[model samples]
Target: MDYIFLNHTADIYICVSGETKERLFANAVLSMYDIMVEGKRRIEDIRKLKVDCINEEDALVDMLNEFLYLFYTCGFVCVECRVKVDEKLDIEASGYYFDKDKDRLKMEIKAATYEYLRIKKDDKWRANIVFDV
Candidate 1:
């Protein structure tokens, strides 16, 4: 797994890591979806996303919130993504709408919070994120 769940008193916390910044972002999204739903997914839709932030941390949070918006408003569940982190965060996400027959909602994530958000890079890129549930 590229991400792991962490202990949080009032929300969901996860530590996500990847070999690259792009992968880190992608893994973060996947982690969020993993927390919310279960079961198989098919690529029935594709979304192009771009987040403009001052720094990596903001980019990460904004990108996650964007996905959450899609989930709650559009019923879009992203199962996979390709990301590119440059001056702007760019992503191509593929997934399907919530299928009652095939998907199960497990958790409700209100938003990705900046409360304890931290992005770091050593041998790999790592981010600590908190989600308001």
Candidate 2:
């Protein structure tokens, strides 16, 4: 499964699964974008960024939070993304900022929190992510 939303009393949560690590990371970013924007927006500019984390959980938090920072600061929205995770996370992502007056803001994400977070592997990689929205 790609992802599913979970009800949280104070925030929101998502469960994501992928066949590979790269796919898992990409899905996580896509889920976050879905929370932040409404409808589709083409990417006018492409940007690349990287994040280094000590472990998978930290990597997850850093990646999502980075996107949050981008949106809050530059109104950047990710339309498509490809991520590679080694000792660090390298991302090539693209999207244009939505006009405040023209677009609908779906939800505001305060942060990606560690509470109730889990990443597992059985047949495929699975993660439980909670976001402060």
Candidate 3:
């Protein structure tokens, strides 16, 4: 995964690959958070959580924002996120949160959009998301 800052505006272009859509989305969030704050990983703890958006793209943004929000507003570190897309097409993630000892993740996640979306050469998921940073 990688990120690019466009020239015209401060928006960020995020690219990620995974075997499945869920994997790609999760990897994207992990990369995004890691970029925001180096080594902001949390210890493993089991918990269940759910987040539902209007559609696939909206759901992706919602999940990403949720993780960032957890870190920013509550200083809640993410241990792991298990996602499940429901029949009605809602995204759910099970994970745990923690306290942040340092403000390592300072960059703001203004917003995300599934503008640049595609599949890779070897059959992998891809997307160039627009961040309102």
CA lDDT of each prediction against the hidden true structure: 0.90, 0.86, 0.58
| Model 3 residue 121 lDDT score | 32
What does candidate 3's lDDT look like per residue over 3-113, in tens digits? Answer: 344443556776666677777666666667655654544454543456774576667777777766666675555544446655322333433354455445456666665
> How well is each residue in 111-131 modelled by candidate 2, as lDDT tens digits?
999988888988988889999
Q: Write the per-residue lDDT of candidate 1 for residues 62-117, one digit (tens) a residue.
A: 99999999988889998889998888888999999997787899999999999888
Off by over 4 Å in 2: none
All candidates: CA RMSD (Å): 1.1, 1.4, 3.7
Query: Residue 114 in model 3: shift from native, Å?
Result: 5.3
Ranking by lDDT: 1, 2, 3
Predicted structure 2: lDDT: 0.86
For candidate 3, list the clashing residue pairs, or say none.
116-128
Output the TM-score of candidate 3. 0.69
**Candidate 1 backbone collisions, by pair:** none
Query: Which prediction has the highest lDDT against the true structure?
Result: 1
Candidate 2: Cα lDDT at 87:
86
Tell me, by TM-score, which candidate is best.
1
Off by over 4 Å in 1: none
lDDT of 3: 0.58
